[model samples]
Each structure stands twice: as C-alpha cells, then as structure tokens.
Target: MSATPADRIQLTGLRAQGRHGVYDFERARGQEFVVDAVLELDLTPAARTDDVADTVHYGELAERLVAVVAGEPVDLIETLADRLLAVCLADPRVDVATVTVHKPEAPVPHTFSDVAVTMTRRRAR
Candidate 1:
C-alpha cells in the first residue's frame, strides 16, 4: 500500500507461541508473538516470467519465520527480530528485509495496547 521498492513481498500477522521475556512467568507460561516482514528483491524477472520459482515463496518464508518465533527462548524482542531478519535474508533473492516482532501478552502491570520491535537488514555485499 505504501511507497516501497517495486519488488517486495510482505507478510503480516504471523502468530506463534514462545517463551520469551525477562519475567520468569512469561517463559514458564509462554505467550503469543506476532511477526511482520517485508522482503525486498528484484521482482522484474519473476514478473516477466510469471513463474513461482523466480520469485520469493512467501508461504514457505512464513513457515520459517514461525519456527523462529516458536523456537528458543530470548529475553528481548530485539533478538527475535534479528532472528527473523536472518531468515528473510537467507533467500538469495532478498536484497533487504524489514521485520517487526510484537509481544501482545507482555508482562506489564497496567493495560497496554502492544509492545513491539522493528529492525531492518540488508544482504551483505
């Protein structure tokens, strides 16, 4: 919807359960985390060919990201974000990745809307 590189794939609202937080209860009980990602690449080749293999497979990418979110424990969302970015950038076609990790069930005493972390990474030259 927004202005972005002509070539990109976006995935949003990917949910998974994981034990990640500073509080012990958070790790013990575990909670849901939502991940959003934008992968940037040259889509011209895929667009012209109309071939699935030529473009990033977002469905498969979602599965990998879910695995990271549902995997090992981490103390901060920043760590989770980095891990997701790695997964996105793993694809050779992806030139850059922007990731957002959301912790809805955060260990906050008062009511809050949400807690999230966003990060962006570029494939190494």
Candidate 2:
C-alpha cells in the first residue's frame, strides 16, 4: 500500500449494518460493518481560508458512506471497500482515497479477531 499524503482527512470506525456475505443467512440477517476512510488532498486552502467549503465536509461524508453500507447487499467486503473509496473520491479536491471495511462478526469457524479488506484509489491523470 502507498503511504498516505501529508494532508489528510481521516474518518475511522464508521459502523453500519450491512447484509454482505456469500452465505444466505448472512444476506438475510445483517451484521455490523465498520469502515475507515482517508482522503488525501491539499489542506492549505482550508487552513488558509479557514472555510469549510475549502475542505471536505466530514459530517456529510459520513452520512453518504453510511447510506452505502445500509443501502445494498454485496457478496464481499472488498466490493464494499471499493464503493466507499468511490464516495471519498467523488470530491474534486481529493487526490487519493483509501478505504477499509471491517467485519468484526465474520462467520469463521476458528477463533479470530476480524476480517477486512482495504483498497486505495488515486485520481486518473
């Protein structure tokens, strides 16, 4: 994975219920999914102007991300991560967006901590 840029807006541990897995039961009974999003962009504008418009509105971002998790059913957390990344990248100011989706209550036979998938996307030149 690439290192995150110096100027970043980090939103972590966004919890939402989602029906996302391969099993039928998983799709029926939804489980909590946690998401983390890191956005890389120039913070100087916001810092200089001290204007919310100059930077990402994190509260709005959170709502949009939560909607995605609660909206549709998917087979894998990877796809979920991809969707989250897209949301972060929607802003024209964001140069890169990295997203991680965590399934703490994963249906694994063995004892484990968590199951997650992380993905990073950069704007196309």
Candidate 3:
C-alpha cells in the first residue's frame, strides 16, 4: 500500500527554551531553540474511517518532543536531534522522520547567524 497525501505532516519552527551548550553560562542562562519535525505515514485508514485511532496524533507527538527537549540538558545539538528522531520513529505509524534543532544564540567568539543541526531517520522494516 502506498502512502496518501494526508499521511505526511510537518510540525515547523516550534520555539522553546532549553539549557544546552558547551559553556557553563550558556547552560545556566539557557537559550531559545527551534524544532522542526517531518513525519511520514499512511493516513488512508484514518481518512476513510474518520477515526483518530487510525492516524498519528501530531499534537501528542509535539508534546512528547517538547518534554524530551525541555527535560534534559545536553551539550550538543546533535544529541538533541538524535533524541528527537528516536522519539518520532517510536511511533509505528511514522515511516520516515526528520528533525531539526536551531540554536540562534550560540556562544561563538565570532559573530555569526546561528547554529543548527538536522537529522533524518527511517523506521527499520
């Protein structure tokens, strides 16, 4: 069976504050973080049946991601991206997942735009 159009959903640019950085001050003060998630699945059953049970609930997914990102302190945005990808793939309905985390205020000595990490994961058959 092929995936329907509704099966794909994107949760974009979710803003949150978290304590993640290599520096002590960055960890103490925290900073703004943006998360973007792309979830892929088959939604035909949900659309035909008109039942929430047949589909992935994006609200719940977002909540879970938020909890994980906000709960733990990590030094690397790579770790955060990996964790978010794991969370997304945990749902059986999700076949492919992409997670992006952006740190606008990275404590780099030089002036720059921002630091961002992006990762893509696929569920193992």
Per-prediction TM-score to the true structure, in the order listed:
0.93, 0.95, 0.90
Q: In what order do the candidates fall by lDDT, top score first?
A: 2, 1, 3
In model 1, the runs with Cα more than 4 Å from the true position are: 1-4
Error of 3 at 119 (Å): 0.3
Q: What CA root-mean-square deviation does each model show from the true structure?
A: 3.1, 2.8, 1.8
lDDT (10s digit) by residue, model 1, range 8-110: 7889899999999998998999999999999989887778899999888888998999899889999999999999999998988788899999998898889
lDDT of 3 at 109: 83
- Report, for every candidate in turn, its global Cα lDDT versus the true structure: 0.89, 0.91, 0.87
Best by TM-score: 2
lDDT of 2 by residue, 19-110 (tens): 99999999999999999999999888888899999889999999999999998898989988998888998998898999999999999999
Model 2, residue 10: C-alpha shift (Å): 0.4
Better of 2 and 3 by TM-score: 2
**lDDT-best of 1 and 3:** 1
